[model samples]
Target: MSVVTLIGAGQMASALTFPLFENGHEVRLVGSPLDDAVIDRLREDNYHVNLRRTLHDGINYIKCADVKEAIKGADLIVCGISSFGVEWFADEILPILDESIPLISVTKGMLDYEDGTMQTYPEYWQEKLPEGSKLRLYAIGGPCTARDLSDHDPSFVAYCGPDFETLEWIRSLFSTDYYIISLTKDVVGLECAVALKNGYALGTALAIGIKEKLGDDGIDHNNMKSALFQESVKEMLELLRIVGGGVDNIMFAAGDLDVTVSAGRSRTVGLLLGKGYTIEETLEQLQGQTLEAVVIATRTARAVKALAKAGKVSIDDFPLLMHVDGLLNEHATLNIPWKKFERHM
Candidate 1:
């Protein structure tokens, strides 16, 4: 059993604590200044207000106020922050961090620089660490959701990093009978797929909603939706290739596109749109919830468009992604250009 320090106190963060505790690890959850109330409540009551769950009893679960104290002698550091918070978090903890500690991120999103350079969360964090540092960074991706994992449901995810040997060690540390871990060295491809999947899940939801609205009870539009699903994968692979990544990472679920698409938060927003709700109405409905797909859609679109302008990738290469971006950000109509889509490319 090793001591693990988890950063952030959101649903994903809270959900993770259970498995670690069950697997006989000493866990310390550290909250940012923004999470003062969350830490205070969790500290006093042994329950997290946001997660609406009590901490598992009979475990050495500790919550710390300061980052330095939380990670003082941690065997591993897991960042549960959202993509938007990673940069600030990196800056906050870098001054006190041990460069040799292994870092794993469950965050899935892309970073876009002002100059239009785009990198995945792990890549961005790796860059933010001191130059020539020994910090090994990894990211988890695939269909594992927080709620499912919180309930101890059987789940699997792709554990990706630079080396298989180190990743295997990480996998063993995090794995439980109910929580399965697979390995990959396709960090770029995995991160890109994870970052981009929420956007595509919204598309899948929209397709499902439109089919139901059209009175197809059989969900027989599986054919049409499957096309949309494959189109999403093609666009993902193209985006990966454009950004110097390989497409072989998608091999396991090669025939089952739905397996790769997680039931993400953005699907709710897309379902609303597919059910004929306006963009204003959708945003109004999702007022309190963090719509990560919305953020990724806008940011990734800007990054991809910048790449297109620089001739790194053509705008035509990602019609579905760009179309969904317009639908999300510009209040554009749901109508997409299906004719321009490449079915087998």
Candidate 2:
């Protein structure tokens, strides 16, 4: 059995191990030094609290107790860290990793830099690696959630990267009867779709929150939500064009991922806002949790505005995007301009 080293002990990291073990792979999980308590709990209880599943017998817990030792002689690497932590973990493990081994990143989100450039995780990681490194980098995105994967519920995900051979091989290792895989060479489109959907899906969540607040009985506002979904897809298509990615590729990234976010925690942020929670109050409710939707929405809005100022993109092309950006970052109201969207219908 091939030994796979998973760097990060978060919910996704723990849940993803199930598929690896199912494929007859030995998993070595390396959590952050800060996650010692979680590691201890997993070891003692023989279960991952976040995943709510008993530990697979083939899995080995390596509590950042020895970073190098944890990763030694692994056949493959998978990073399931949060967007904020991916770079830190990359820095720690890059030196210990051989250039030949492939690193698949399940972390999704754009990295907003002080320089006013927003980059995908793969681009950020590639820039961080030492010069002349040939490390194969891959990314996973789309509708699959950790809970579903851990529970062996049917799931589908998109895999994209520059190395087709390695990507396909990694695909073979993870794809099960329950977990389906789709491949794409359009990394920019896929990564941007994955990251941008969280920001755009906030609008749909706002609609859900408003529906719940109105206490509407027997009146499914699927039309209203469909409108928000269309707006999100339109904005995502515009973004893909501006960033030199194909519009059709958005179906794989934005279309699939937006549906997932609508049904997941990413929607919770917008729901709180719709329920009349102030930004501060909402953040307080989400204390100690990293809401990538809120973070990405705020950062990407600024990044897009910056890109517009530089004349790289047309600001007027993204009204919904700008509106949501203002709502998330500038403390603007939850008002949406329905008049501006008549042409879309």
Native-referenced Cα lDDT, model 2 = 0.79
Tens-digit lDDT string for candidate 1 (1-345): 888888887777778888888888888888755777887777776687877778776433344446777888899888887766877777886656787888888888887765557688888777787868888888888676677788889877788999998898888887889998889888888887777777776776787768767894765787777777878777777766766667775542232235434354577777777878877898898887778877877777888898878887778888887888888888788886788795554
TM-score of each: 0.89, 0.94
Clashes of each: 0, 0
Model 1 clash pairs are none
lDDT per residue for candidate 2 within 261-318, as digits (tens), equals 5566678888887777777888888888778888888877787788888888767767
Clashing pairs in 2: none
lDDT of each: 0.76, 0.79
lDDT agreement of model 1 with the native:
0.76
